[model samples]
Target: MRITLERSNLLKSLNHVHRVVERRNTIPILSNVLLRAEGASLAMKATDLDLEITEATPAMVEQAGATTVPAHLLYEIVRKLPDGAEVLLATTPDGATMTVASGRSKFSLQCLSEADFPDLTAGNFTHSFKLKASALKMLIDRTQFAISTEETRYYLNGIFLHTIESAGALKLRAVATDGHRLARADVEAPSGSEGMPGIIIPRKTVGELQKLVDNPELIVTVEVSDAKIRLTIGEIVMTSKLIDGTFPDYQRVIPQANDKEMRVDCQSFAQAVDRVSTISSERGRAVKLALNEGHLTLTVNNPDSGSATEEVAVGYDNDPMEIGFNAKYLLDITAQLSGDDAIFLLADAGSPTLVRDTAGDDALYVLMPMRV
Candidate 1:
């Protein structure tokens, strides 16, 4: 079997699918990518049992056939080929080796029977919907940083996606938490999303989906079942297994009675925190926020090293109070704010604090305090 395709087209498709192949695999077939050439198109697929990605690119198919080869090895070979060059993939009579010829370079890679490759069979989808790429990107970017990495609480390792009626309108919401901080973002629910069961998209899938949604004009089709989800973007199709666990109710941790309010320039506050935290040790880098009427003092004390203090004027007029927070957590939440001013609603030095963006009400964050 033989097929010829443009190097650019082959490279793009491989770039999208090869990422799903794990670097190290216990199974031999799992390390290879399945390639099928048929009807003027070449389809490529790679999987790690839990997640699978498939993409098809246009090709001149002289003979239709299928085989498997090392995913990363082939990708590297195609990537090094000259731009705009054509690539020819041909298999021998015994299908023992595949030849990749492009320009003056040729490579012979050991081949495996396509039948040996596994397929992640998606039985049926209970809900399917379409969403704008920009909207999807917003929800992911706002909350991805808060996803928990603790293996024990597997439920918190992914973003919880569901629909809810808020302000008399149905909205699609994404929430993630690590017990210390929580991020929640919302977008207007698209049609066909109503009554969809909430699903926890695994962390790996969210990362890959984020990379594909860079084009704001693209429309992404989403199909979800109880245990698996499939996303179609342009010619690329991605299927991933959903994390099977119950996500803790994150709303209870969000403070509702945080009366003390503080408003400060986002950039200035972030820079001050960064400068002060430089003096903090690597472990338990806590920054103390001492708030007074219209003034805030940021301090970091490291007994082994030194101390740091900076003052910034704020819009606070409440009773003065001191609160402690992780320097890294403060910076993470601030980076997600797309506004000039960051609003912090505080209850006390121990309870959780709520953060909001002045630019929009679509996203919010709650951060737990650290002992300083």
Candidate 2:
């Protein structure tokens, strides 16, 4: 195969697909990206068994053929070439190696037969929908931080996506939890998204999808079945296998009757927590919040080090109370808030606390308290 394409165009497509390839692989083909030169374009594909991404770019093809080359190596070579340079890719007649030439630099990469590359056969999709990129990004950004990293509980390793009737409207929701904290966000359900099966999207796929939805104006096409999901954005297509486990009932964990409420400036409260938590050495150290009529005090104490305290004014009318929470968890939840003020609903010192955004983002948070 012999093809010539603009370096910038090739590099952009490579950047999108090459991230699916893992550095270490038991099968050699799994470490490489497949390149197919056809009529007027070159197709680039990479996969890691669980996830696959493909993209096509216009190229001048002298010969139509296909081959596989190391994904990272090819990406690095094209990245260092001169901007706007023309790149030439040619494979030997014996199909053993491929030569890459750009400007005055040239390199050869070992090739694998295209036949050896595994294809993630995406079966027929049961449901299809179109959603604005901005809405999709909001769902991921609000819940991704709560996804559990524990491998033993595979069900909590991704976000739970489904449609439900809420407030007299059909809404699509994303929920994620790690036992200590939970995040839930909702958006209006699209016309074709009703009665869709709930799917658990793995963490790696969620991260990649978040990167591709930066263009807010674009309408993303999403296709889903019981076992897989496919997303198409412009010339790029991403297919991923869903987790085969059942997600727990996250709605049961959401607090519903917390009557005491306190409203504080989100920025000031987060800054105070950060300042006081600096005295502790552990990441999950508990920070105590002491609430009064119109003021709040944050305190952190570490026996090995010292103690720190910061005060902030809040709008509270309930009786005085104290609650403890993980300092890191507090920061993670605060970072996701899109409002100037944060509202906290508390039932007791031992029960879970509910948090809401003043910006009316249709997102809610549940945080378990820690013993001080």
Candidate 3:
């Protein structure tokens, strides 16, 4: 195989494909990326058995053929090439080595048989839809932070994606939780998204999907089945196996009757939490919230360290109350709020507290209070 392409184009395609290639591989073929140069395009594919990504870029194909080479090594070579330099790749007659050249520099890499690359099985999708890039980005950004890192509860290690009826309107929702905190967000379900099975998209897939939707101008075509998910954006196709675990009913955890309500500037509250938490070094990093009419005080106490307290003006008219929560959890939820004020609906000192953005109802967060 022989192809010529601009350095920048080849580097971008490599960066996209190499995310799935594991640095240390037990299998030899998995460490290499399959390169197919045919017609006017070069297709680069990489996989780690569970996740796979393919990116195609237009290139000047002199001799059309296919080969596999070290994914990261090739990427590094292309990245270090001078700007605007043209890269040339050619396979030796024996088909065991690939020669890469640009400017006055050249290198040879061992090539593996392309026929040995594993194919990702993406069966007939039960549901298909087209969604705006921005909408998909919002759905992921609002919930992914709360995904559980614990492997024992594998279901909670991913974002739960499903379609639900909200106020008689069909909405696509993403929910994630780790037992201590939860995040839920919804958007109008795209056409043809009906009857889609709820699926748990694993944490790695969510991170890789974010790269494909970073461009807001593109519309992503999503196909989902009980076992797999496929996302196509332009010349890039990403496929991953869904986690085969049951997600707990997150709806039951959200409180609907919390009466004590408080509204505070989101930025002010986040800053106060950050400042006060500096004093505590506990695993939970618990911070106590003291609330009264028109005022809120955030305090942190650590016997080994020190104590800190910060007062932030708020719009609280409820009875005096004190609630304790993990400082990092509070920061994560508040970072999702883009508006000026964040509304908190409290039940008491022991029950979970509900939080939302004052500007919109599309997203909600629940934090299980800790005992101070």
Candidate 4:
């Protein structure tokens, strides 16, 4: 294919597609990015069997052709070229090699048959909706930290996305957990989003999609089916197979009877937990929380090492209660709070606790207590 494009534009498109290409591939074509030059546009596609990304950029196509080249190598070559340089890509008659040139630099990259590239079949999606990029990113960022890395319970390895009717309004909800803690976030359901099927989007796909949502002005179109899910943003599209396992009933784990509430400054509480965790290096990062009337004390003790205790004034008027929790878990939950104040609801030392932002009730987090 003979195509001319600005160096920066090509590099930007490559960066988006390259995320799906694996570093080491058992199949030769899997290491290459498929380039197709057609009517004033160039399409770059890459996949790793599980996820696929396709990006199109405006280019001057002199000859209509297609070929595959090393994804990383091509990306590096274009990246190192001088800014504002024009890139020329052409393929020989036999299509055995691809020639790339920019100013004084030129190189020939080995090519693979475009026919060998895996094709992702479009699934029959009955439901589709549009979401603001910022809203979707917030849903993923707030709950992704709780996704399980353990492969044994495969259902817990992704974010569970579904629709729920709460307070007489439909809401889009995302939930994730790894047994120790659970995170849940909700937003107003978009137009035409009714009756959408619940799907478990795998962790890796969620991470890759998150990078593409940086542009707040862009709106993403999402299509979901029983077997596959597709997300389209601007000129880029991503398709992936959905996890087959059923996610556990997360609602059961959320505490409904926790009445003892404590409100603390989010940043201060996180910093205190981080400081105390340093003392207990061998005890799995445990920190004790002792709460009293209008005062909260954080303490960490390691028999072999020293102990640390810090007290912060809070907005709690409940009876004195002492609870032990892993400092890391506490920080993870607090990091998701969107406001300066974090509200914690505790039933007792032995019951699970619920946390929420003081500014709104759109998001809620629950953490199971740990013995110190």
**Over the stretch 1-372, how does candidate 3's per-residue lDDT look in tens digits?**
999999999999999999799999999999999999999999999999889999999899999999999999999999899999999999999999999999999999999999998999888998999999999999999999999999999989899999999989999999999999999999999998887999999999999998779999899999999999999988899999999999999999999999999999999899999999988886759999999999999989998888999999999998999999999999999999988999999999999999999879999999999999
Ranking 2 against 4 by lDDT, winner: 2
Report every candidate's CA lDDT. Answer: 0.96, 0.95, 0.94, 0.92
lDDT of 1: 0.96
Worst 10 residues of 2 by lDDT: 277-286
Q: Clashes in candidate 1: how many?
A: 0
lDDT of 3: 0.94
Model 3 TM-score is: 0.99
* Pairs of colliding residues, candidate 4: none
Per-residue error at 351 for model 4, in Å?
1.6
TM-score on alpha carbons, each prediction: 0.99, 0.99, 0.99, 0.98
Clashes of 2: 0
- Model 1, 49-151: lDDT tens digits are 9999999999999999999999999999999999999999999999999999998899999999999999999989999999999999999999999999999
Q: How many backbone clashes does every candidate have?
A: 0, 0, 0, 0
Show where candidate 3 strays beyond 4 Å. none
Please provide, for model 4 over 1-372, each residue's C-alpha lDDT reduced to its tens digit, 9 standing for 90 to 100: 799999999999999999889999989899999999999999999998889999999999999999999999999899899999999999989999999998999999999999888988876888899999999998999999999999999999999999999989999999999999999999999987799888999998999988999998899999989888899999999999888999999999898999899999999999988888889876478889999999999999888888999999999998999999988889898988879999999998888999999878988999989887
> What is the C-alpha lDDT profile of model 2 across 1-372, one tens digit per residue?
999999999999999999989999999999999999999999999999999999999999999999999999999999999999999999999999999998899999999999999999999999999999999999999999999999999999999999999999999999999999999999999989999999999999999999999999999999999999999998999999999999999889888899999999999999999999999768658899999999999999998899999999999999999999999999999999999999999999999999999999589999999988
TM-score of model 1 (CA atoms): 0.99
TM-score between model 4 and native: 0.98
